[model samples]
Target chain A: MIAIHGFSPSGNCHKLRMLLEPLGQPYDWVEVDSPNGATRTPEFLALNPNGKVPVLQLQDGRTLTESNAILYYLAQGTPFLAEDRWARAQTLSWMNFEQYSHEPYVAVARFIAGWTPLDSPRRAELPRLRERSHQALAVMERHLQSNDWFSAGAYGIADIALFAYTDVAEHGGVALAPYPALRAWLARVRATPGFVPLPEPDALAADRIAQTA
Target chain B: MIAIHGFSPSGNCHKLRMLLEPLGQPYDWVEVDSPNGATRTPEFLALNPNGKVPVLQLQDGRTLTESNAILYYLAQGTPFLAEDRWARAQTLSWMNFEQYSHEPYVAVARFIAGWTPLDSPRRAELPRLRERSHQALAVMERHLQSNDWFSAGAYGIADIALFAYTDVAEHGGVALAPYPALRAWLARVRATPGFVPLPEPDALAADRIAQTA
Candidate 1:
């Protein structure tokens, strides 16, 4: 049995749940909210000194942190992980892109608008964040215009990483309507067998989008 | 032939270079200085929508950006990438850690100290950068204390991703002396077969605690 400690609203956390659902793996859940600083507590800190959520306590009790890491763990050897060398490389390419390009912009923007108070000090960052974030989304939209998946022709960890934030990017004031291809890709991923919706409280909106064309 | 666009001083960029040296692969180097905004050039941005350094251009004209992605691409199907399932997950775990926890701190600190002047506007971010950067280093110190290598108990791309920034961490005004285990791990990586010294602007001063240890 594995244990996941993270808040449901978080894209990083949602990514783990997404992969776990597809893998049909059962794991205990412990919520660690970032705003409440649950991850900073001594016990959780011991597991991941970095103090971030989506830490997966493995079957052996050796804990692993980082959302993408957890996804890769569950997805490997399943139909989700690519078999070809270059295809596998492409899988990681999108994963890296999510971290470097997509997540910083799109996810941060969402957090600012959706989680933080309207008058919070973090609001000042919204303008630049929105600009940088949309720039990244446009990139994804362009890619999805031609390719159904981020890499190769299958759903994998790469899609899970990008989809978590991207599907609900509007919460950050990002208008996904402009990106038709990205919207189409989201539906395609949702249609994957054993696909799971994010466990977030207001996840209905995203789930509907995912299931719809 | 692959074309890699990156600045020599960048640790992430060097991650790709270090691995390439070991593989004996020849690649065309298109120098891109993010500090100078060279990556923002239209031609470069066309290849990489993110406009970041370390974009790998494949022979088929498809471009791959992000350092770890390139490393995975160039290293796939080899001993550099773990062949076993669990080992592969471990490798991804560390690599993802490099992105979320490690890079944002250590890599950012490096950019601030090395790329800009002490009094530059970007230096304003230093205080927070410093604390978070050390927090990340501390986690590494604890991990390196027991594990000889990350994932598969052998040297892999994770080490290369981590080593690039860690080896020259002092450049970012980050001190590595307190972390004995991490320091020793650096030494082991340095002594590994096919290790390539990072290209320095001049010569690397050998007097640092990181080198001396």
Candidate 2:
């Protein structure tokens, strides 16, 4: 069985757990709490020098980092990935957008709100992060207005990639009220069989998020 | 023939050109000056709602965004993408690292140096960007010390994706002198068959970069 080293509240880590459940692939989950600096330790660094979750470890002990890459690895032969060449590329484009444009702002804002203290200096970054996060959401909204899914006309890894962050965006103070289409798409993703919701933040983290809010 | 809408000096766009040259594939290059607000125009947005480059338009009029995705699209079934599944996923892990960890700092630093005026407030970001850029470089250096290539144990799209920004990192005030292994890898990429150097920055951009130095 594959073992995933992950932080439960992280959208990046949730991307893998969400997909694996629906794919019916059994895997062990190793909680690596990133906020407490576990990822930076030498022991964890040996698994992934990049030191971010989620890291997928094969039963043979080889490991893979970067949540989206792990999704691609697990989904390629499955229905979660498109078979057509162009469709696969299109799916990859959205995943890249998720990592580059969306996650940086959306996920970081959520991290600041939930993981950092209420008065943390990183809170100063929220306005700009929120602005950029909205821009990314707007792009998704525009696409969703015309199409049903982010991946080659289906709810696949691209949707999974974007969904993980977007669903929890309000934790970052990014409201979904303006994007009806995007909200509908989010519901569609939830309706997928074997879907699993991201774990809620722990009590302390929730307090931070509430105070920041 | 395929048509590539790109900005010549962008590492993202150059990834496609660099690979296409070696692949002996014929394509039309439509230079879209992204630095001048070209990408934000409605027409360009039609091609890529994310309003970024490079956008690959197939002869059939299908478009693909994200430089790495375009590379994956063009490289599939070629030696550029690995045939083995695990190797292919490893390649993607590196590419994801480039976008998520490396390019956001290295490429953005370069943009601030070359595209923005020297006195622009964005220049304030340089010190931190360079610190993170070096951190990314250090990881690459560690990997290159033991391995010769980034993709499937060979020179391919992962190299191309990383090479785009790394080769121009000095423009971002990121000195390459410390990492001998990374420098050697850069040299090897340059020596690859059909390698094409990134085009020179325009006079105004060159001047901005020089002033920052």
Q: Top model by DockQ, which number?
A: 2
Q: Please list the residue runs of candidate 1 whose C-alpha ends up more than 4 Å from where it truly belongs after superposition.
A: A117-119, A199-213, B117-119, B202-213
Which 10 residues in a row give candidate 1 chain B its minimum summed lDDT?
A: B204-213
Each candidate's iRMS in angstroms? 1.6, 0.5
**Candidate 2 — which residues are off by over 4 angstroms?**
none
Candidate 2 TM-score, true structure as reference = 0.98
TM-score values for chain B across all models: 0.91, 0.98
Clashing pairs in 2: none
* lDDT of model 2, residue B5: 99
Displacement of the residue A92 alpha carbon in candidate 1, Å: 0.8
Write the residue-wise lDDT of candidate 2 on B1-213 in tens digits.
Answer: 899999999999999989999999999999998989999999999999999999999899989999999999899989998889899899999999999999999999999999997789989999999999999999999999999999979999999999999999999899999999999999999999999999988898888888895
Error of 1 at B69 (Å): 1.8
Please report how far candidate 2 places residue B149 from its true position, in Å.
Answer: 0.5
Clashing pairs in 1: none
